[model samples]
Target: MTRLTAALVILGLVILVTWALWQRSTAAEARADLAEQRLAESQQREAQHQMIIDSLWDNARRQANQRRALAKQQAALTRIASNRLATIEELQRENQALRAWAGTRLPDAVIRLRKRPAVTGAGAYHQSVRDPQPLQPARE
Candidate 1:
């Protein structure tokens, strides 16, 4: 009976030691996999940010081209151009922030949030706001 009890105790100890060693080896692999996952997620975030910046750039470019084509021919469009310029500046600022984010490896934290414009109607012209002629009443 004493021999049997001692054998059971030895068997339990052996099993516990084996389990501990196995856990240590598996933990290292899990840590490596976690690092790889973090890298992949970072890359994906950068790609998404790049796409957003590209879209904003396209919108700003289109607005500039339209402003050029209109070229003081229409008073409403010129006001719209001013609004567009404001909008473009906002976009450029945000774009620069995103560029900085991408240039640095995606940090775990963002220092500052980007500011966005709050203009209505997508920067289209309103008859009321004549920027250059603000001193006088708007001409029909």
Candidate 2:
């Protein structure tokens, strides 16, 4: 009876030890899986943050380029306007000189033009000047 009781106790201890080892291995596996998951999640967040930073830089670069283009366009327009104004002033001066010459050359004609308000209606002067004799070139 004593030997049988000793054998039964040994068998029970063996079963208990096997069960504890199995439980320990399962817990360790669960901890390793949890750690790996956390690491994966951290790497993904880092990649996402990097992408966001890159996009911001790209946006800023594009805006700067657009601003530069706009500034260049504004400078070109300013130059063109200045040139046009200068040309218009030159033409006005030339027109004044021509008017003075005409007054000296044909005083009577100028007086007649001044007395008569110009025919402003469309085609009013189209057929008005009809001298039967064509003008001859002057002999100097």
Local distance difference test, per candidate?
Answer: 0.74, 0.81
Please give the range of 10 consecutive residues that has the lowest summed lDDT in model 2. Answer: 127-136
Residue-level lDDT of model 1, residues 24-127, one tens digit each, is 98999999999999999999999999999999999999999998777756877788899998887777678977556656853222221122223377343453
Candidate 2 off by > 4 Å: 1-4, 97-140
Tell me the tens digit of each residue's lDDT in model 2 across 1-140. 99999999999999999999999999999999999999999999999999999999999999999999999999999999999988877776789875566457555545555655466765655533442433345455
Query: Candidate 1's error at 129, in angstroms?
Result: 24
Error of 2 at 56 (Å): 2.3
- All predictions: root-mean-square deviation over Cα? 24.7, 15.3
The model with the greatest TM-score is 2
